[model samples]
Target: MSSNLPKNFPGRPASAPTPSEVPAPAPSAALPKNFTPEMARAAAALQAGAATAAGQAPSSGAAAAEQPAAQARGQAAMPGGPEVTRGEIADHFAQRIVRMVDAHRGDSSRPRLYAIEFPFTDFEFDVAYALAGRLGATLSASDAAVDDDEPARPLVMLDRVLNNPQQFERIVRHINHGQDVQLVCTRAWQLPQSVADLVDATLTIPRFDAPRFAAACVDFYELGAPPALGADADWVPNVVPRDFLLNSQVARSDIVSAVRQSVERRLRRYATDDALDLADLAGMDEAHDWARALIDEVALARSGAISWDDVGGRVILLGARGVGKTTLARAIARAAHLRYVEASASDWAPPQNEPQLGWMRMNAAFQEAMAAAPALFFVDDVDAFSIAPWAGMLPAFLEQLKGLSADDRVVLIAGAQSAEHVRFELHRRGALETTLTMPAPNSQALAKMYSVLLRGSGSTLAQADLEHIGLLSLGMTGHEVELIVRRALRRARKDGGRDVSKEDLAQAIIEQRVGPESQDRRRLMAADELRNTAYHEAGHAILELMRTRGARLRYASIIPRENGSLGFVLPGVDESRNSVTRNDIVEMVRVALAGRAAEEVFSGPEGTTSGCSNDLQQATAYLRYLMTRSGFHGLLSLDRSFEDSPELRERAESMLQAEYAHVLGLLQRHRPLLDSVAKLLIERQEVSGDELTRVVDAYRSSHPLV
Candidate 1:
């Protein structure tokens, strides 16, 4: 081996060889005069291998030299290697010389020579121009000389004609031949296969600084740096230290184990931690008070510096739409000083690279925290994360979480609309450790929510208005309450006052209606519809009063409202345990037909309203149930088939026909009640139960029972 190579040469010996030790070239040698002894040795080995493969013994040194010479000449005549067109040769040689200069001068210095192929393609020109500009070098067309006087700088070939592979191989061969070349093949698509094979390195536009490039390199190579580095002016062997590599692998394994531990610890923590107090998020005083107590219990347990034990377990907050699940989850994270990582179900993707890398990242985040205390990984919209495409990945994620050791001290809090949905997905996988259901705001909470919203807007609302809003928003969530309040506030502001009136709140409530109310309202005209609804309800009340004279009429309104009703009448009655009677069924039928009768009498025969659709359906079903299921029909001789029997059916039909006629007659006779109720509805747009009762009592006193 050569001993006294340049210091820049890597893996070379420091000392020169003695003269006697240096072997002279053999007489049989036929290699290029400039070929190094090492190159000659490599060539000799190749020749020997060729000879053995041909079933012949190793050739003599002289014979081997002759054989390679003949082979090279034969290869030169073959059309296999890179084709060297006149234009390609110039471009290749030029690029070779430029690379030689760049290699020798270092990155900071510009190469002395630059040769560019003429009429460059867009890709070629862009690359060449960028390189020349970067090095502060000049670009010259093919056939152009660098200088007539001094030695020209190496030419850089920007071959725009050769295909990708041809250009790539040509560049590689020139470098192997010891030519200083840097080829830029702009016509890469022309020789895709060849380019794909020989291009060892690629330089994308926008060269970055060392730090970015280093990070990018690490990511691309999927490898880490050595634990230590040695100071040197020249390139060193730079093999990764065996100890460091081994330590990193151990550390990675430890991290994976720690992550598994943390998940388990989190589940246990949430189980014991006090339930989340969501009063502030709820924004209702009563709810706040109630939630505060629960929050305080957790706070007490977590008091005086949080430790692994203080950390809560994984909590899945489940609720309907517009509930405060997300809000509560965030609040918990903020209060507990836990790092929240929010991920939607949709955000979960199939795991790539390794099955455990995602878990590893998550684990790494909390591994350090375990030594100090515990942290929370709040995953939001967890249901979305469990979609079918991500099912395979989800099990691994959940399994990794389940496998987490207790020592890791991390909590997992998930938020979803339905705990059942998540439970269904994870129950089999055993993902859910604890499920907390968030109920909609209660009446008191609803009132308090309205008050809070009003107070924030510097407005004063009467207790009556608050009560009304509360009653209307009974089944609504905290978010719905907030939305209702916000809408009311906006109305108040637009009306040029901070005070929200009862009418304003009611209007806001109507405007914010969802579901059926949000549908088109053009099914029936308003006035005719209101009148019909009032008459129909009046008929029912009047008939009920006639059948059960003691039954008191509480209230009736013909106001067009959401949820597909034109009017409604709630009859006042004493709370009792009494079941239904035949008389009650007949009276109910009369009340149901009151609106249609009133329409027929007041709005004429042509007057009809779509409002009766729901009423008709309900009344028919009730009558049918009573006659058949309740055994109220007189046809005792009939079995279940009585409903299909002509005689039994005829009897039920006659009874219903009479009841319908009676209902219409009652509505027609109590025209005074109809007029009064309609007038009130038009004026108030909404009549309370008390108001309806008072009106009904007045009408009954004036006109007597039908």
Candidate 2:
């Protein structure tokens, strides 16, 4: 074996043979005269197998090679060692090449071309090199010139062509100029469109596994015996260690150990040392199932029981920030026992004056993830990575993304606030095609979270109180609920370490959502102003109850919020209703304007305070939507620009006037009910939905409308 051979040379020695010896060439020798004895030995073993199958006898020198050659042949015939073995990817390519040769024998009608694609492993090109040697083909990376005496051999290009336009053009030129050369492309994502146009057929190789690894080792090294393959030997990542392994003087017995150590050094550690399990993720039923399925499939893939394509590990989690997308990704990594690598898209974005930096950062991140095979590669805020096709870094970014998608060892999980704004190309095949939307936890989900939090805290809240707290925390994320629970627990601790009460949780929710109540404002405001604020909120609540198509009122309060609001009336949307009609729009407008109408009903039109300004703005917005977008006034959907027209302006004024008059008349007719609710609001400062409902129902029963 020669030490001067290229590291990627077919049958390059893993460890050098003694300098004192000259090796014998076997009967199967078919390599060119200048080839190293080591390559000749490997090629001989493969060729002898083919020759023996065809009933050829060995030469005298081949008799000297008989024992070892037969052992090599037997190794190739078995399930796991050497390049020419059945079921090995190299064997499949060999058969394909043989078929192509037979099909094109002595024919000069077309360019003899064969292309195949495979997800690249570290030693994939070596497979091509061995195949080329066995079949008398030319390697693109080989320096040896083909002998002018022999017939031209097929040109095998296992190296990447997409990134090298010059080499691609040369290949295209050779084909177009009627050269008598055959082209074989062993590695491709897909042939470049121009090359695809000329290709007659394309084939794909199966994914890499333990058997593939064993075959690759035999081709690259002179192992004393088949490399010992553990159950998870395939879990070792294929990276750049082949260069070092080929250059070093590692013993045959130590070769697999050295490679495993290199993989261990390259592997990443989980970012969070202590990640939560799937059971810890409450209120995310769909997300739980998604993560669990991934965990199971990943386990199967790691054990070589299935391929990563079967796992389908690339996915994007769509949700608002803090909706637990990151948490879910980490949990999946933990559950599957895979290396966890997380990077934010913003982290990869280029800084000032460095447009190419973004792609470089993204490429580095991908490299790190690939080094750590069986890894969870998470990109947070992936929506930020979205860029226009014309952007300077888009090509490089996509190229790096293409590499990540092609590799099966790294499970890619990306998070985005929404998918609508993400780059359309990012959603193309082999990228973030699988989208999982994580919605904010609803009331029932919130209840489950509260229950979990309470149990973890060693405190108990009555089931009814949990339900109430959950209802009050509607539309909140699990993160928000967690924080609110923490605040409530703190409140309980401050109050002599008692169990968290419903009031404590409710107060925490109020403080978090609306801001703390303004005790200073309550004390400083005039009595008359307080009365007016109460009545204004009361009016909104009353009209909300009266409107047939409006949202259900959650609560009404006269307590000033720290956000500079004198009062607020919270309403919850009915999730069951998927669509709204014209009348529903009118009803919403009436609710928006009810406070102004009530202020005028109590304090004459001139006496109404500026408190109705916000109410008027809300009413105007809803009315604008109704008049323009909803086609409330005419058949045509007019824009707000038409508000300048005299006819449209008059129509808008009449609509507002009529809606206001209608609400005022109702406030007048329901005067007793409005006053009662206002009195209750003034007494309680905040009124619950049940309390307001009771007042309204009592009033309606006593004063039936005609």
TM-scores for every candidate against the unseen true structure: 0.46, 0.61
**Which tens-of-lDDT digit does each residue in 542-591 have in candidate 2?**
87887676555778888888788888887765656768888887877788
Off by over 4 Å in 1: 1-277, 280-310, 337-341, 346-394, 403-410, 416-430, 514-594, 601-606, 618-662, 683-689, 700-706
In order, candidate lDDTs are 0.48, 0.65
CA RMSD per model (angstroms)? 22.1, 14.0
Deviation (Å) of 145 in candidate 1: 47
Q: Predict model 2's lDDT versus the native.
A: 0.65
**Where is model 2 poorest over a 10-residue stretch in terms of lDDT?**
18-27
Report the poorest 10 consecutive residues by lDDT, candidate 1.
234-243
Give residue 706's lDDT in candidate 2 (0 to 100). Answer: 23
Clashing pairs in 2: none
lDDT of 1: 0.48
Candidate 1 C-alpha lDDT tens digits along 540-588: 5455445563345434454455665655655544334247777677667
